[model samples]
Target: MVFRFAKTLDPITLFHAPSLQTSTNALNILKAASAAATAGTVTSNRGEFQLEITTAPPTTDQLRNIIDYVTANPAGAGSNKTDYAVGEVIKGAKDAEDAVKRFKEGGEGTFIRPITVDWTNGKAVLGDNESEILKMVHQLEAN
Candidate 1:
């Protein structure tokens, strides 16, 4: 009489290191975008501005940090101004700078610059400023 034995096998496991890297890159991009939006508020005489992160949609704590920084460091008015109009311009400049820094720091892969100011009316009105921001983001991403 002859006897036969059965064999057992285990399946292969896969890891998502690349996906994690991509996610990290995306988060970095968002952070950069927030910074860029804030940086866009810088002016010559007037100081930088801040934004209300709670009102803005899809903004993270990192972005809110920029706004908070500006609010804490108001120019002439010490956070008691009613209009907050000038602050808006400063905020925009700061936001742009932040985005640019992120792009240069290797956040071009998973982010896009926004195409609109976060205020109703302002003096630093540059046409297609949003497009300009997007262009910077795309440039970084392409690299």
Candidate 2:
């Protein structure tokens, strides 16, 4: 099975495996980075985030796992209105073209570029690095 892993802008180590454990591990990393970013520890110098994967195009289930994790985490929204909205947008775009671009570029080959998120200007942008999964939930709640 082709496994895809997505990570933030920080230099975090990851475990590669087709198990929930791996997914959970990655989620934890995201949570920490998100928290650090919120606390001003991880600034724009990180330049968004990147999601690294072994698949040419990550599967929906893989993406959903990461999205679900973020949605259930505090770093995502934390009850902030603007942040929540941005999270919603990120969620909605999970299956978007941009999301597809964020997936690792390889598989039948090797070597891939990292994805970046645009957190500046309060604009929550999802990419290979980070995604705004909570944004979708917040949008649904607003409607």
TM-score of every model versus the real structure: 0.19, 0.23
Worst 10 residues of 1 by lDDT: 8-17
Q: After superposing candidate 1, which stretches have Cα over 4 Å from the reference?
A: 1-19, 41-143
Q: Per-residue lDDT of 27-126 in model 1, one digit per residue for the tens?
A: 3443455455447632222222232212122234433332343233346544322222223423323454564454345432323222123232211111
Measured by TM-score, the strongest candidate is 2
Top lDDT: which candidate number? 2
| CA displacement after TM-score superposition, residue 76 of candidate 2 (Å) | 36
lDDT of 2: 0.34
lDDT by residue (3-115, candidate 2, tens digit) is 97865353332323333443454455555655655566644344334433332323544343334333334565554323222223232344434443443332312211121
| Displacement of the residue 88 alpha carbon in candidate 1, Å | 38
